[model samples]
Target: MATVRGEDIVNTARTALGVDYVWGGNSLTSGVDCSGLVQQVYARYGISLPRTTYNQINIGASVSPNKLRPGDLVFFDTDRKKSGPDHVGIYMGGGKFIHAPRPGASVKISSLAEGYYMDRWLGGRRVSGVSADPSSGGGYAEEVAPRLDAHELAETYGMSYAFFKSQPELWKLLNGAVSAQWTPERFQAAVKNTSWWKNNSDSVRQSQVLAKTDPATHKATMEAARVAARQLAVKMGAILSEKNVDQLAKNMVHLNWQEAQVQNYLGAYVKFSSDHVLGGMAGAAAKAIKAEAYRNGVAVTEQSVLNNAQYLVRGLTTMEQVQASIRQQSAGLYPAFAEQIKAGASIQELASPYIQVVAQELGVPDTDVDVYSPKVKAAMTRANAQGQPEAMNLGDFTQMVRNDPAWRKQPGVADKTLNVGRQVLADMGLGF
Candidate 1:
């Protein structure tokens, strides 16, 4: 069973204080009758009650007026002709109760001492699961001194005292839940559950905190931020002057904008100049730019490359230049593939010797080498281009062929292909 507290119930009910009254209405925001408010508040804390004053009066343990605490259902015989209790409200500490009095009255706090209520007080009943505060003698428990002072607690949670002090209701809710058993973890949970903490944008919350706690320092910081925003605006070709500088600076402080972010946004907005080679390029273009710089033996970081990309990409090799270099390297490394390279064979085609060996491992006959070798080469080209990743690497290609469906389907071919694969490797001065 879940634990329940009258403190929590009171806290929940307080949220609907201004709701309008409508007989039989169940909503907390729009409207709720007296019984509806009590039913809804209990339902939030996982307790269910009858929907009307008459039925709700008998469910919970009866508590006399002197022993009533927050969360006890307070009844009143408002209708003179009615036989039993005809209206209800949830008791809040301090001799007060909250309810939807009638069709015209909105949900509001009312004193039990008020003459009208004093004459009609029916009784108070404590909800079964709502834990009573023995120390309060039937009222809400007095708040105990926290282990850490407010300022210390605020600092521990990375907030200023002023920001913490601004949230009294939130603090009250948290204190009600964990004040008796305060631990750092429990207190931190309370802090994390707050809207202020959940939405604590550093630029807004932190900047606001600084502005309140130390105005002199905050002024200096805002000035610095303003200056940075102006310089960035100028760099990005945005207008900035005395007339709008203060507002722009305040906006920057609120937004947490800095140089790199502004540059990235403006870079995309204006688009890079055509002569600036890498200016507008990103993703694959950026990757190609980095590879080109590396191949050219130039040292450059992604950031540095992006910063001066338009100029940097100009120094990179073109596709034709790369092909010429490959042709030159191929002639020096493998003269036999020179004609094939000149014939426009792809890099995968140049690995024909390895592909033939893989085809042979799949039990492809010598007479079929010409017909099947192309298939093996095609497998190494690219998946989108018709090849598996396993076929891309020469070392993994033979194993891929060995695992091929064609090879596995043949009877008595495995042992013969294994021996053929070994002999093929030996002929190439290599071994498994």
Candidate 2:
């Protein structure tokens, strides 16, 4: 087994300083909720982690809080039910740990001595060598395998060429399976076995319907289906194009229902496109059907498209669900990403807003901007201290920010803007 140094782990955790917290999100960008932060940090150092705090606690040998060191995970049961661990943070040594606190909090360091955290503390686990290597078959090695491949399969089944091309693993898997000597039933069964495919099972059934239907009757059925689908599409598109978040939130329920219908249509369309055995159907009909199907498919499942819309709607709904105290406290807390997007700020300025916004929204002031900034600096500093050849520098930070979602959607933000921001930050001594 190999060891990841304490300083290296701290540095890795620091890089995630301002990432937003999404309940089940673990990615560095879109935002990582609590358990996600810990999972992502350790993963960067080749350490495998469970997706939830409770499961994560069992990852490595248990260590008493007194014996905790940097990179160790600190577990807590905030709910007080004692049912299971509900919150987690990374031990950054010297009685401090880094964590994504809650809805209104960003990733920040907090003292282990704090009464709140100390009372809920469920002890710590050292994950340094938990999963050294999957090929070598270590304790946690299997957990390290990428799960995004499932998403790839979903995107492929959805007939998203752009997503499939971006995710080669999924493309290869599907392409390989398609090329293999399997009947349509076998292929459909294999796809259904995946989590992604299971979520979109409606699409599968719709596809099967299209595949098995008679061509002559299909034309009439198809016309009726198109009319129904287009009406839903028009409604969803109208809601999505609105600028007001409140109206958007209100429209989401309707949109979600419409999305499901579009997904069904997409599935039917993809199956039709790939297995167009009906030689008698005119090319024009084929083309129209295919176009409608692809449009509906993307409308229902593109990562950035549907997910983003869902997120915005959900966030607003959640905000409205909470009490006035939580909402007011949340408003004061400084939205990590939203603040950066106010009025006219460049997207570069908004990078890392996810973590920042979560911290602020959660009303966890102890883990607010003032506390977060130094943690990031310290993480960067420690990375440099470790003498690791690949320690992230200004260039890395700039690249990270530019690639971050905060910058990805801004009005005038482009690759060129990112390069300029990198240059500017470097000149300002913040780069590297």
Candidate 3:
């Protein structure tokens, strides 16, 4: 879709980002119909749209799908069982459109580039005073069109249009994410809630923003995440063949993951597999894990994938360490090794910080311990890595790592805390 330089219609449409879909309803908070949603939002800026899908589709000059811009109204022949512009939504560029889907559903955002909408797409119409095509006489749309589409969209969400627009980079991000059909609320929540956005340096925040929003960047990172999660799943799955891959798929459904989110979470679940781990573990564990990680300041950036990879390596090494040390180290070494661990590190630090320090001191190969690829490791230190992995200074998983081995073995602080309760856990030997 084309980018226009003036007031963005997407701006106003956002005010209703997550409203419920109430047939015939027109309130943004209470809900609205597809056309009601369109008309009400546009009306806020005084742009009139006939309060029905048929009339709304006729409000502006026709725009070809390929040439559609942000404020254009896209019509769909939804209910293919039916015909002709039965559905209407605002195109938000990058192949996404925003609208209130049908009953029992909320006024959520969705994509026009794919899914049912792609097949149903009828056409688009540019309202909100976007310039008419140069071929259409190089004039603007009627003065009656919404005067402040972009500004209104930002205002509805409690942000300044000037501040939002001034950051071309952020707009680029919003364009990519919204175009990808990410809800504005999710995008906003990510910004306000994620540590990478809240506490990072300005440059790091921009990089994190780009990594999360840019389709190409997010795609690549997600691909790696999928691979990592899958590898973890498979490796752990192999240990419990009875549990099977189908279990993973079921876990996804039961968790209510979107069609797009299943694979990524499947990857994460695989990364976290254990005999005691259930498919159910994924749903509860993910939020808790992410929340804990966030609280501890783990920056889930492009580097975070590496950090996960590092975690995979660390877990592998810990197993290797246990096996090797079991055979060679004297009984006393177990207690001695446990003594060196410092308590209260965050989970991020656990991957390498807690382990590697001791592993290196204990003569673990740099090969076995420093898992980050040299290039990724280097990029991490740079304030600007062009969206590549940066130093994951976001948060640390250190203390968690330090506490674990202590709980499992030797006379450490966590040992006295009654892990004594796990004998049945030991007895079952159940797994992922």
Candidate 4:
């Protein structure tokens, strides 16, 4: 999962606190309903959400209240007399959620543990970032695994092998399922109306962790995301007038786009326009890439977002792209990755100082985890031909290198190797 900052989402929503409530309104500054307020805040991040409370709750994966994080959508039966979920808010952690609390009230943050909401709490949802999935009119590509490949990992991550094998399209549902907390029955019922959800790669697989994006383009776009979003919305057939587009463009990008009059005749102006420009589905893939960068918790730039869009356009997912980028940089480790894999080592095992040095030496953007699996497989084949057994993991290889007294004296080798060793030692969290 990508590391989305709930703090960021909460802070954006925080900007709208005290705005007047308007029925069916979707604006924060002028006025907005409960769902509108939540929808608008998330839209700024390029996440598309349903306008209505009922639809919003039904779409994403569910989370137990105990696991609630910032940015989660919290549902409620505001009237206590109403049937089903009638109101919603964005959870801001610390037992609080922000919303436009009906007429005569302003947008404000309230507690989930409050008496009125606690009694009527319907549930919470975690939106799955499947923005470019085929079900949502996607244009990106992905590979299909054989029906037989719906094995234990598939089940472990989510879904039962027996069910997906019996129903090929069920794998497609898995993409939406595990990411959020949507139940199988609910997902099935909802997808029944959409033919796209049934069309999935034979077995669902994450393609790649994409390369770091081109920062220049990313900066250019994010700085102008609002204008670009409006223009693209017009291109995609949303009913934004040139005047509306210009007015929208004039404001800061973070303005309430969830406002109905501001964005569309029906609801907030085209919510997913930021992603649509990249590719129908490429946007979510782009978010996934940034999410990984956030998880890596290292240097992040506009390039990370750009790289996400670039690779997703070609059907590579975030992790797959990251691997590809590493391979491009790991030319030195083609031999090392091969040796490690030949010894039947796991990819996790290959994330070592050895891979780190090759990355530095090649001047490629890489973390310890970018060792390519394909080169490892090919190298394994060669090693087996030479009668080598699966004998050395990356750790063992590093130890062997450490033990060799002459390895320290080898010209052009010692500096690079020692630097990596020091760096690895400094990364206290990762176990060799």
Candidate 5:
């Protein structure tokens, strides 16, 4: 599951390959600035992250570059004038990251070994709520300590914590559940199954410790189980109050039912208990399941669920197996593509493969092919030809736009200014 989630992050980044870099832009089709791309990709997984590069650096726990993981946010102080973070990129593991470099440069993978980047590297920040389990060791640790006081815990964890803590009976029941001998993996899976557990890292750690201490403590085991169950109940209650039970049921088509199958049963429970008969206890659990189902999507049957689950699990495994293959293909090709663009390849020639790869990956029609219209091309060409002697590159064409009076004043005289006036008359495109 961890591997699958990581691959999803990488795939999402890959889908944005070749998108033109635009300052302060975020959307894929329109354009994306550096931070915007990272923000949108994480948002797809229900993780709420800050939008700005500066804010992003401060949100999650800090980690050293050596300890950096695939989804970690790596920051840079691009301008020495800035006191802190000025730019950011999503670490794609193996000493590479995807970022929008600058104007005239599209989204691309860059090496950390580059001297320019090494000098500006500021460190990394991990996103919160992404679990710190040893099995999923890459996630950042929780910076804030857990609240011990029930009232404080209630506030810290939100209403779900309040609901469970208010019922001492339920709390004791759950404490017992955690004390039982369950496989560490199974215990962690159960913790994630509940929405409350998903956000409470401290609680998860405590439960895991309790479960590992002694196998003979039935009361401890039962208490832990009850807490988990009550947490689930509170989540369901919240969903029921929102009147989204039906919608939750509809979302159950994506889960692997054979593994846990909790969504189907929870969907039925929500349908049966609309009146809040169980002191609104069942409502919260139902709502929690509905919320998870909505985010993760649900599967219809056991087989379908298993197949989907296997697909994700195996997809991640396959990705690792073929990493060399993908990198080999990409490394040889991407640099050549970059070289071609720099060597005066037409925009069509330069952008066609990039557009096709990105379009196919993102499931969007290829629109990048038409991004540079013929009119724009002609204008650029005329500007280039006119400014050839005085201007050498795209920057020269830009300067010509600013300085050439005839090119600017005559509207369509770009060709005449360069070909007839400058080249023929031995006059520089710049009048001065």
Candidate 6:
């Protein structure tokens, strides 16, 4: 038997495009059913096929939907009640096929992209003896084959079209190596030889291999990635519409992101966004940390401090919770400020009112209160740093002020000291 060209078989099928449909009828001139149309078309090319859809599906090697070429036999389950393919058509290039319909319909061209056909699509088969050109490239079809559609193949391989298009070498190799009789082993070998594939990540390569070796797992993983992307977007306050979510999911699948990796990415994104926003929870935390760092004489940036506080941000749900976390961190870092923070007053708030009281007691001008307030706080910080008690109080402030030159300069200070000395001496029976 002579080898038949696929293009010739397609031409033969086209000749029966106007023929009427008849159940089990084998003559193309009279009437023919779907399988009859296929049988008669292949007979013209000298390639014998089975008489019915069920047997015809098992005629030769099976074809992936994405790998379908012209002259390949495509099958569908028109009747859901039936167990397997009950309808058949001859695939034409460019997502179309020619087939006869039920009783009154004639043979005509239809699209595989149509919803009805896609939903009912079972699979495709490449019959033996069909070739693009058996005489070319040492009887191999790979050399003379038409370029495979990259967009379709990308979708089949579970990659985004944009990403697939970006890699010129991958698509170029795919179009060059793939033929109607392509297999997963051949495809993997061809792709692995490329520089991009060899240098690519293991997870990504595994996902690509899985798409060919185990389509069911690959599809489920891709779907799970989509769901995870959406959930992470929501959690991070990232505005992701359905379209954005789909693209993100595709990218993740292409990169082979596990759930934990996705969470880390979203967490970093949320932290970066919140830290940059003024008046956000992260800003508040940074501000609090900055104040405590200053009081403790520790040098750090607002951004750095905020980053360090991320540990506290974890598992926290609200702004209030975040605020409380910041306070707790500050108290932990500077134990001396723990009392003031617990009392709901920042270091500045605790120092301001008490500094005014100390200045008034020493009869210092109101204008000097601001100048002395920092000095008093600094003294307290220094004292705490020197192994003193980790508490802030009025007594600490007063003692710090008394030792200062500003307090000693107040009027009537000498006479008051001499009077207090004479009273203490008279009481002890050693009066002047």
Model 3 C-alpha RMSD vs. true structure (Å) is: 26.9
Output the worst ten-in-a-row residue range by lDDT, candidate 1. 308-317
Residue 345, model 4, lDDT = 44
Please list the C-alpha lDDT of all candidates, in the order they appear: 0.65, 0.51, 0.52, 0.55, 0.51, 0.68
Q: How would you encode candidate 6's per-residue C-alpha lDDT over 134-154 as one tens digit per residue?
A: 554576443223343544444
For candidate 1, lDDT tens digit of each residue in 258-368? 655454443433323355433233333455555544332234565654543322223333445544554555443334445665676544445656647655666555445
CA RMSD per model (angstroms): 22.9, 36.7, 26.9, 30.0, 34.3, 13.4
* Model 6 alpha-carbon miss at residue 290, Å: 3.6
Q: Best lDDT goes to which candidate?
A: 6
Kindly report which residue stretches of model 2 are placed more than 4 angstroms away from their true locations once superposed.
Answer: 128-432
Worst 10 residues of 4 by lDDT: 203-212
lDDT of 1: 0.65
lDDT of 4 by residue, 57-98 (tens): 887788777777667788888765658889988877666788
The runs of at least 3 residues in candidate 3 whose Cα sits more than 4 Å from the true structure, single-residue gaps closed, are 1-6, 132-432
Give RMSD (Å) of candidate 2 vs. truth: 36.7
TM-score of each: 0.32, 0.30, 0.31, 0.30, 0.31, 0.36
**Model 5 poorest ten-residue lDDT run:** 250-259
What is the C-alpha lDDT profile of model 3 across 1-432, one tens digit per residue? 343432356777787888889989989888898999888877776576798997877776887766766677889897767666898987776556789999888877776534356556688887645543233665553322222244333333344455455556545555555455454445565446544346555544443434433547645644554454455455433222324444543343233335345434334333333443323333333344444444233334434333333333334333333222322322122222222222333322333453454343334454454323232233233333564322344233233333445334534545534454465566689433
Q: For residues 219-315, what per-residue lDDT tens digits would candidate 2 score against the true structure? A: 5554554455544433333222223333322233223335543433322222112343211112222333333323211112233223323322223
Report the lDDT of model 3 for residue 184: 45
